[model samples]
Target chain A: MQAWDISFSKLKAGYGSHVVLTDVTAALPAGAVSVILGGSGCGKSTLLRQIIGLSKPLSGEVRVAGRDICTLPPAEFRRVRRRMGVLFQDGALLGALTLAQNVALPLTEHLNLPAEAVRAEAVRILGMVGLSDFADFYPNELSGGMRKRAGLARAIIAQPRILLCDEPTSGLDPITAARMDDLLLSMHRRFPEMTIVSVSHDLASLNRIADYVLVLRDGACVFAGTQDALRASDDPYLVRFLNRDGAGDDAAAGECAAPAVQASLDRWFAS
Target chain B: MPQRNADDISRASPPVKVLRLLGRPALRALNAMGSVTLFMLDGLRHIFTTRRILGRTVRQIYVIGYQSLFVILLIGLFCGMVLGLQGYYTLVRFGSVGMLGSAVSLTMIRELGPVLTAIMLTGRAGSSMTAEIGVMRITDQIDALDVMDINSVAYLVSPRIVAALLSFPMLTAIFDVTGIFGGYLTGVCMLDINEGAYLYRIVSSVTMTDVAGGFLKALVFGLLVTTVCCHQGYKAHLRRDSVGPEAVGSATTSAVVISCVLILAADYVLTSILL
Candidate 1:
């Protein structure tokens, strides 16, 4: 597997007319962990989707390695896409398949491996994710964290050079989230040249695993640089985000409350 | 304040407003038809191009064909028995009770066999296809496939469509046979309409053209139903009627309704052509 640098040159993306990411321009480094930082609905997932070629950008270019994927023909783009893996939120493992079967999908679909070889590879990946015991369990039977691990196993089974994770630690307990972060780090160690890009708001995980950071806010890329640069910056929005400020929350809380709602709450809880 | 009607809303004349109302749905229906056709073509293309499709296709056949056998048998038997009873009585009225076999066999072979089989499968397998694909769409499994550089349509839909193609005619034949037997139970066993007369008329009245037409209808109905159901599920995310989990339910409902309607409509057209 060869790590591929992903560069977005003035990329704009969204569904139909509702633009979620506007004029975004940044390059995620090859052979390193780059964390995309943003609040919910701040175009983090949209950017990840654009990079993964799940949806084409409305305008501009997304270059993988050196080729602009947006301009590539469908057949050509599919070849480029084969070098990548994506871990979606909620795991997104197929409910019909067992954990090992889900993990084996990429290999079985893309390669000419025999059944035993594919199973062996799947088991190895599952073991990496610490899900060897639950190989036969359906996705629905597993907990959310376990499913996420299985999703990670499936994503990396083919040893893709470019790995994109969408909020990988979003809904996990502290211990599980930490384990997931460590697992991602270990993956980077195993595949030293693999480029790992994660979309997340987890400051802790970002601090631990991120070699580079790209922060998005209000449909724009606010910052694209090293984590140290992001930390040392004095920008107000960046400062607020980095410090986990509650000022915006207070303002939103003010607008969200009403006297009618307060009165209803009082009446309801009066008993 | 008074309640406003369509005339008050946009200041358009009644005729223009009516035309506007009708045009919107008419255009939407046309767009849906075009989309379903394109989806079928795409799925059909993948049937030839996808590697290792046989295993998936066989699995789908088991689900869509083998699993539906009992229901098809049950429905076919009842349909046949009802036809025999009704045909027997109707012929008895004209002192032509011997025509019961021709009536039951011809009816099953020409029309009811293919149409009922498709409708039954639409309810049984078609709805499941829609719901399953719809869920996949909502849950990002389809996108997962896309990210994996695997053709989601090839993986999810092409197999089902191929399975339906192979399954529909076979099931229709079964339905026809079961229905004729059902007719025998009612006409020959119950009414004592002369068993040989019943079987002999069935063989005499059913021509090769009739059987071919029935099979052709079966194939077309299978394609239409499977394609429509899969399309609804595949594009569940784009549905304007709902979003997220609700979209899956809406897509499934729309798939089954649209499939059933298409089956009946296609049956009419095919029957007209075959006749």
Candidate 2:
């Protein structure tokens, strides 16, 4: 099977007065995973939004499967959305809905399956995510890692050709994150034709899966290269970030990270 | 407590006191009117911004409106029966049971139908929309829609607005019809009047103007119900301040209160002009 690809051309986007992505031009190979890494509020999610058509670029276009998604009508756009799947940063599993219902939402909205078939498909996907026994359970009933897995389950329930994930492993423990990484990799290997694009601060996870890494800082890419190239680069940010033991870096200065990063690396940006 | 200075001792005259007393209702009216205006403007903005989402919206309206009819009609039937029984006893004291038909038809068709129906819809459908949209808004499902290149407003608000526009009127008509029947049963079966007279008075005594008046009032009330509920939902979507429950209560209450006030107000104004 051939690979899927996503490309953005001269894209500009913002929420009202704040321009988040400024003339972003990038490409993600079909059948390959690309990791867009950046600090929180540095417009990484905004760039992801531009690619998915959630956030419109103030200029230029986003092309997926050779069509400019920016120019498609809303219906056509939603039809385009059927070709891709997204796991939200917060999981967004619709807490009130059961795990089965949450996973089956896209199917119910888009497919022609019978009720039993939809239920079976939901169960099958939930089983793949290791939530087979919890089909009747709501999102609030699950743990964080389970919620992320359930989100991934829902994203792939329709068997989309492209996957967009935001912080797939942010809240999980190291072991759980690795488990999720393995799960994603196995899925990637199985659906090798699907393009997987994820925005994450988890450098370790990125190193495991990312074929191409784009480093974002202050709303722009500071580096765009192969993961091996990024790891070998002498840039203090790359070295310090990849080491995982480094005291600080501007990108890792956000919430829930090490306190050492805040004290030492922030001064570098201030200078 | 006893040390009253000139500023503390300042007192208004009886006439001035009466003026303040008279101004309270006006002030309340202004506030309610202001909220309604703001809500309507916001609803119109959402409607226009997502024109292509109308097909789904219309389907939603059809489902909400038709599915809700039985409940609305059930409530309307009881309401009409109670009104008929009460009106009959009240008219009997003056031997004015003949006037009972006019009273029930006029009241039910011109006022209670729209008001009660709007209130009922607010409780059933309006609250659901607010809760659903509120959750979606906070959890960034709306943002998800945006990323999928879909307009959240079109996907969410338009169906609800269309539901209100179509639902309330159908329910109000049911109320009007049931309430008249309730009156008929009381006047003909219980009171032993000519069945023809009871039906004639109901069908004839209610002028084209009265039916028209009911429809006009219902149409506007439908807009108000949709507007208030959708605004509360949208606001609940944008702000995660636990205002959803409070807004739901306020939206339902305000929908009933405003629809009644406007229906009565419009009735008076419209009656004066048309009659």
Candidate 3:
């Protein structure tokens, strides 16, 4: 359980012929829950992809534990990736495999563990996610919240040093989202050395689980500090986002006055 | 404003518009070919590089090969019966009814057996493979594999390719045997042909070379159909607005059409060489 910090320096990422994020630089502290906050299409997911080595940056470097992963060869990159786990937005569980089998996939693929051990570990992790009873069910048979929980169990089963979650609370009810936030915080507490980077639009979940916050706007790191610092700041985008005023629309004004700031603050803290 | 639009249309002209329309797809096809070639090469490399995929390849053989046995057998029987009926009537008119055995056996071994087997597989197994992989792509399962440090091509595509390559020739052999028996049922049992002449004529006319050539053709057709299907499925995300069943449906249709065309084209080329 060694701590490893993730650093991005001048990282530019995008698809072919389109640039999403540019000149982004940040160092996610070791052994902390770092929440990346941004509206949809703000390149939060894109940056996550770069960090996971699923896609290379358009320019600059992504360093994991002081090693530049951007220049690593395929074999070396895979070695680096083996130390990390990712929970995708849709769970991305193999529909053909049952919940237990899905959780055991990384273990079965990467390790030569005995079948009994694989099954035992898979069941143990499923229990941690409160899904031990649903071990035999396929992903499609599970509810949306169950699927996300199963995905989380799979992500952490390998004991990865870094856990990347993409919108884990998305598409869930408020109660379910709160439970998800609790599970994430519990996971962080359990593996005190693991760095958890979650990209989310859920302000409530962010306030509950985040030890540090990174706010992205139009593919730039507009703010990077603690939740308390973020709340005390007078930044317009942060204020607008914190208030949940027209958060879905990209054209929403950052310069608009925060009319119900006190009520929003109360609601945020209450959740 | 209407006149200005008309002027703009005229400025482009019919020939230029036609060229633009034709050029885009032509370039797209070329690009697809290049990408598919690279994917196939990667798959080939992984076939030897990874030994773990052997079990998956065997499982795939059961799904892609063993499951298709009944349909392939039915098609072979009906096809041979039709060939026997038609050849018998034509040869009878020319007073060469004794040659019916040679005609049916030659046709089955050299051409129809390999070609029809490929077409059936393209429709049955090839389309299914495309749809399965397409679903995996759109659902982000493939991306999940990538992030897990698994080579998606090695884990997914290579096993399928290996299974298809092994199964096709065996399926073609089954088609040949059943087809010959089907011709026997029609030619001797129904057409009043001499039984000794029928069996003897086939024995003398069809050589080891012909059987070998037929097997080679089947092997090639299997590679083509599987490669095309896998390529289509792997590249499903590249298609604009394609998702879920729409992506799967399009990939399945495209795999069948493209595999059938390539089978026919390769048939001509192989015929020239083998014959």
lDDT measured at residue A65 in model 1 versus the true structure, 0 to 100: 97
Judged by DockQ cut-offs, is candidate 3 incorrect, acceptable, medium or high? Answer: medium
- Quote the lDDT for A172 in model 3: 98
Off by over 4 Å in 3: A247-271, B1-28, B240-245
Ranking by lDDT: 1, 3, 2
Candidate 2 Cα outliers beyond 4 Å, as residue runs: A65-67, A72-79, A243-271, B1-101, B143-204, B207-220, B231-275
Which one wins on TM-score? 1
Error of 1 at A195 (Å): 0.9
lDDT string, candidate 1, A1-271, tens digits: 5678999998899998799998899999999999999988999999988888778888999999989998898899888888788889999999989999999998889789899999888998899999998898999999999999999999888778998999999989999999999999999998999999999999999999999999999889999999899999999999999999867577667675588998899999996
RMSD of 3: 7.6
Q: Quote the positional error of residue B260 for candidate 3 in Å.
A: 1.2
Candidate 1 pairs with clashing backbones: none
Give DockQ per model, in order. Answer: 0.78, 0.20, 0.54
Fnat of each prediction?
A: 0.87, 0.37, 0.70
Q: After superposition, how far is residue B116 of candidate 1 from its true place, in Å?
A: 0.9
Error of 1 at B52 (Å): 1.0
Judged by DockQ cut-offs, the docking class of candidate 2 is incorrect
| Better model by TM-score: candidate 2 vs candidate 3 | 3
* Chain A TM-score for predicted structure 1: 0.95
